[model samples]
Target: MVVAVIADIVGSRRLRDRAAAQRMFDETIARVQREHPLADQPLQPTVGDEQQGVYSTLDDALAGVLLLQLALPEGIEFRYGLGIGEIRAIESAHRELTDGPGWWAAREAIETVHARQERAVPTARSWIVAAPGQDEGMESRVSTSNAYLLARDAIVVRMTERERRLAYGRIGGLSQSALAEQEGITQPAVSKALRSSGAAALLDGLALMTGERS
Candidate 1:
């Protein structure tokens, strides 16, 4: 199967330090490269806040994305897009290939997440499949994609509730003690959650849901 992957930092601007951000990016790249099969995958830098690469199978592509997500520094998360299709080599000698339906599908998957991210919908993820002729492998990919979406939504929902509490605190101008008492949580927990980058990811997810620019 033809698979492509895209991964990026969640809230880079708030990082405040370009050097540190670059280090994170570099480390993230190294971590991804260490993953099997994708160790040699060609990584192409994309404009703005993302990077892309291609894989020959869904297993490798998905594993690579998940690894990047887990390896990211605190407050960072990843969204991935995978497409399966035919890859036709233009010139075997040069090893160049032209875009096909698989490529289009992968781009669509990333665009789907990009559009969602603009709405500030935190922790959103999606998968798209493109096999004109259904086969057992294609069927399996579809099933796995559905499962991934469901689990991703569950995580996003939980994060949303936490962010709502934090937003309420900020909006109401509540002191740490007051907010803690109101939420029945410790003052330190309240401060920690609000200050964490995960909350920023929630805002990014919100941007995705609301159609705001990321």
Candidate 2:
């Protein structure tokens, strides 16, 4: 099975410089993909305010989305939804269209999260849903993942921009000293930012998602 992801830019219409914001968003996604090549198909704009991508696994989608969240500059963000299932393409004379349960689930998941954010949990930016017809373990997996995402989004929303930059660098395997130099701050300051902003916890969570730990 593959993981399909759909993302929508948040508040793009309200931005004064939509073109510049789009360029920045594209550049950041490119840089993150270079550092962590987890996507089967890199995210590409599909329509207004939306993008689509595929990953070989759910963990890749989760980690990839997190990288994107932390990498984005201040005042720009994307809400992400991931679905796991088989994907089939319908090729027409003009272009190929994706149609399958996976895409459907992704649509459903995105709608669910959008409604959720509007009502509450405004920081919640990512969610995953598995297409039905899986094994008995699907329910547990989905629930556990959603719970983790809720906490993850909350922590990320509370982080400062500098804290996010540090987190992104650390994910790319940069040392705290290295990040300090890049940010023009001392090592202790970088350490304090990571710890205080909950970036250290987010890093640990990402590591766990990627199976970097047993």
Candidate 3:
């Protein structure tokens, strides 16, 4: 079993330079993969405006997508769906194909997030669903993870570009002084942004999820 993900550009039609936006998206995904190394298959474009990836665990999926959210540049955004289940490949004469419960769950998740975005929660960017055969323990995890995703997306949507960069840096193990140098601000200012922007709490939550804390 694995955690599968589906993602797409949030406002594809409105992008001023579609090519550049895609390039940046690809680069950011590469950087996240390099820094985090959580994905079983690193996120990559699968078709027009869409991407896919695989993770070995739900925690990895959660952390990977969060890193992606912060690594992406201003004016570019993507929504993600994560699924936990089995996946299988279909043999094609010309090309490989993918199918199975994991992808189906991921599809459901993405559609759910899209619906949520159109409804009351416009900032919703990620959602999770589990395959029908998930055990009781897995189902409980799915419930808990969904709650985390909602709060994480809400905090991320409110962050300024600088705040996001700093948060991303912190998660990648950068010091506040280093982030301040990159942002051309004082180290104290970086600390203030990390606190005022809700990033510190988010990092703590991620740590707990990843077993970095008890």
| Among all candidates shown, the one with the greatest TM-score | 3
By summed lDDT, which 10 consecutive residues of candidate 3 come out lowest?
Answer: 205-214
> What's the lDDT of the predicted structure labeled candidate 1?
0.58
lDDT of each: 0.58, 0.87, 0.91
Clashing residue pairs in candidate 2, if any? none
Could you report the Cα RMSD, in angstroms, for every candidate shown? 11.3, 1.5, 1.4
Writing each residue's lDDT as its tens digit, candidate 1 over 1-214 gives 5776555555667777866676667776675575333533545556667666777766555545544444455555556666667645465665454566666677777777767757765446656566466598678756766465545444443454455456434433457788788888898888787656254353344334325322
TM-score to true structure, per model: 0.56, 0.95, 0.96
Worst 10 residues of 2 by lDDT: 205-214
| Pairs clashing within candidate 3 | none
Question: lDDT at 92 for candidate 1?
Answer: 64
Off by over 4 Å in 3: none
lDDT of 2 by residue, 1-214 (tens): 7889999998878899978988888898898899888898888888888989999987788889998999998889999889888899898999877879888889888998898888888888888888988886876878888988999999988888999989988988899999999999999999999988988988898777668721
> Clashes in candidate 3: how many?
0
